[model samples]
Target: MTNTLTDETSVVLANDPHWWRQATVYQIYPRSFADANGDGIGDLVGITSRIPYLAELGVDAVWLSPFYPSALADGGYDVDDYRDVDPKLGTLADFDVMIAALHASGIRLIVDIVPNHSSNRHVWFQEALASPRGSAARDRYIFRDGEVPDGTEPPSDWQAMFGGSAWEPVDDGQFYLHLFAPEQPDFNWANREVRDDFLTTLRFWADRGVDGFRVDVAHALAKDLTYPLRSHAELEEMKLVTDGSHPLWDREELDEIYAEWRAVFDEYDPPRIAVAEAWVEPSRRHRYAAPTSLGQAFNFDLLLANFDAGEFRAIIDHNIQSVSTTGSSNTWVFSNHDVVRHPTRYGLPDDPNRENAISKRWLLHGGPASQLDAERGLRRARAATLLMLALPGSAYLYQGEELGLPEVADIPDADRQDPTFFRSPGVDVGRDGCRVPLPWTATGSSFGFGAAGAHLPQPAGWGSFSVETEDADASSTLNLYRRALWLRRDLQDAEELTWHAHPSGSDKVLWFERPGGWHSVTNFGDAPVELPDGEVLVTSAPLIGGALPAAATAWLRRQAR
Candidate 1:
């Protein structure tokens, strides 16, 4: 099979052997992107409308969050059917249009595959429940007898992500275990039928022309069959619940299943991608992303690593080293639909409260900080983006991240749709705070994301922080993102990422030298430090030393010597 490489060598490399490793992906939470049919919800058409925006963003692929048929129990995570699009989101024809538009824009599409579980309302589940006994349909799920038996308590003291036990008791003398919600019954991967069912779904989408998938909880698909639940005395309850106790994760059975899937992918003239949403430690995440396993798994090093200067540098360096160890391909993403927006997590400076000054800077361009403050934060974000693009692994962009979007602090409980919030609701769970509909128009209601009174709220003030407004303003963050993306694409060397640590007295700065002689420098903290003594190629930093004005990020390139 002599595959002809594209002018962009990386694209060819991505399309070859294992395409996902080298692919650049942009994630779109369909409900919040852009509503084209005035349904108060962003649908496939909405995503199709913004294909140009994504094309300009320079991403090789777009990862659409689940828009499948569902009961909306877990904000679509608990899928009812993998075969069709959710009516609220769009029709099957609409999805075909989206795929066509993306392909026209030179972008591939990867849909979310929630194989770990399904909505209780799913037909399969209904069938299983009706025939809980020795029925072929019952073989699809893990149906066991007795209360997940524990020593005078529930089995394994494992807590559900939403709170309570990971198991829910069923009336039929047997119980079904759900790692997430009672409504989401875990599929018994041990069953051949279950494995075949998922593989069939994979073929269904591939035949439909999807680029691939960002598999939901790939690691969670398998579990520890031992059924050994931890004792109640564990320090943190969550620790006992999620620490690799499932019966299906990383099981040899799973590895073999992947090998089968890999064979299927190989049959296609061009390889199909399968990126696992494995979000554990660096080492474990690697296991799922090995050559024969998932092509690429999500990287959490940039998101969950220590905030200390030395720690950050080591983390980045370690990630590069880790991928090298795999001798296969890999991917990286700092933020996604599942986590809080980076600016907020990166700790941007909050604005002083003012009665009349509520215009939406906080949600769109970030909070109302001073020019230095804004510049500092913007630079930090850019530096991060630069590092992401310059790394050996593929990078993922959550929607609105390029425009330096920050998390919204106040979404009403009624409007929240994330399953993470439904579980342990306190300081907000997962990333609903950052998952609001995108703002595409300055003067239109809901930023023109949808008709007024939509399911999701647009930022409080949409007249300013919108795509229409930012497109006209040269200095707008949206334009800056476009510039960076275009520059990356124009520079052939950008695809061949080459990185080296710069000489900084402190570990705060993570310096990278890209293929086209571009350098990116970053101080991950709120306090400013002196820039290294190199040609200040490009920097988003405001000042050399002082309070970094919070969320400040910058880029610098060394002059040709």
Candidate 2:
């Protein structure tokens, strides 16, 4: 690498108002990140203690997954309070300290905000339960009268996004809509009271010094008042509707709601910002990231792509062009709290017999884990990281991927808590595997996650991927990330991408150049390829025989800016 990295390099772009556009944001799932209390779970104090580690990795921001009060029905997304922290996670005082610690480290904190639904334990939902039907207390949530003579059945055939029916029946013959678990009741955005409460929630966090927000289930906030009856297949097709006619998502009313959010965000001196976690179609996603709205949308097309050059190339080009119209940067993610880890996913065989591209199934026993090419998987994953970081948009890293940690994939059913697992009746194992506590030390009861055993089981080989081990080895994935992130600061000046020419016209090899002479070359094929002519800055793997090996990526610089 031509440039030497210093601590000051991380804060060079801190003055930019749209700092998130080309930033590296790391997602920390609080319950599994670190446990300062040693109670078999992670907490706010744990996250605050790790600020130096995050700063060393060079992430511009840290997106903390929900630490709010909850019964853990849906992995903390089932928020019980919008204004305070969960006692198990930490108290409000601890949260305030964590915010200060992150900011002092030059790392902005983006808290998770769940607007579409709230825990059934929330005061408003409990009030809806205590009050009679049609009362003002019941107006804040989506409660409707059941159809048919008996009123025992739900209002419609709608199903939950996790599993089972979306509508749950109450004792009074009234049914409330919950697009997710029954424990999380959907808010009726049409209600003035519901809208007003969320506005207050935004201001509350902003006042607490949160730099921004990562809005959860952003697309489902507004639903069709007239719940239409349709099969699951028909609902999937409706995602492509350009007119926002989907019964449960992407309604036209979302623009107005986000505009209100943006107004509150702009009230801050640096201007608080937000990124939407909407899974709408690519063409329709720009609306969520418009200047007047959240200002950024997660582009998950990379998560759907297999280990191939053509797929990655197409997705990169299409996403850049798609989001360019809005003048907002696209957010690229491969793994998150909700899905399988990318290394394990890339380890699977390339075939149609595998789970469908949309929703793949990973079993805890006798399933996809039985057949895994971990070596090739980690190789491809590292290569993918260079590709993602060198792109024209922002990049997001899941909690443990910096150490190249593979999916646990074998957590016992008895310890599982994901609603997806229980709701699906064990046919699907849910996300417990990927949520295992991080290994901080090579020798510990729970790999330094906590004094007690992790709430989710960790594998016997957990120590092999511990932070202590990775930190010692120069060739470790952790080093690759630390080095790559430092080099990535130079790539931020250019926002448009241009594909580089490959001497041999092979689709399996991808070579692209950004506007500032920063070129990234990736070889997804099973053969070594000659390196392009330039000074080698960084590479995913060591060069063999003066050529880039298979499943590796290299960043070459023709000249400095």
TM-scores for every predicted model: 0.83, 0.95
lDDT of 2: 0.86
lDDT of 2 by residue, 12-113 (tens): 425458788898999999999999998999999999888899999989899999999999999998989989899999999998888777776778888899
Q: Looking at model 2, report the run of 10 residues with the lowest lDDT sum.
A: 1-10
Candidate 1 per-residue lDDT over residues 1-561, each given as its tens digit: 222223453343344444455567889988778888887877888888888888877787889899998777777888889889999888988887778667767787788999889888889889988885667777687766553344233345556666667766666666677878889998877788888888888887777668777888877766554545444454253432334543434444556767777776665657777788765656666667776776677777666533345655666677767777776554667677766566554444433331111222234332233322444444556556655665656778888887677666566768777666667566334456677777777766676777754576666775576788888987677776676666555443423444455444545656566665566556665556555455443334345453233333445555665
* Model 2, runs deviating above 4 Å: 1-15, 227-237, 351-358, 363-365
- Compared with the true structure, all predictions reach lDDT values of 0.66, 0.86
Where does model 1 exceed 4 Å of error? 1-19, 148-156, 226-252, 306-308, 348-379, 425-430, 492-506, 523-561
Worst 10 residues of 1 by lDDT: 353-362
The clash numbers for all candidates, in the given order, read 24, 0
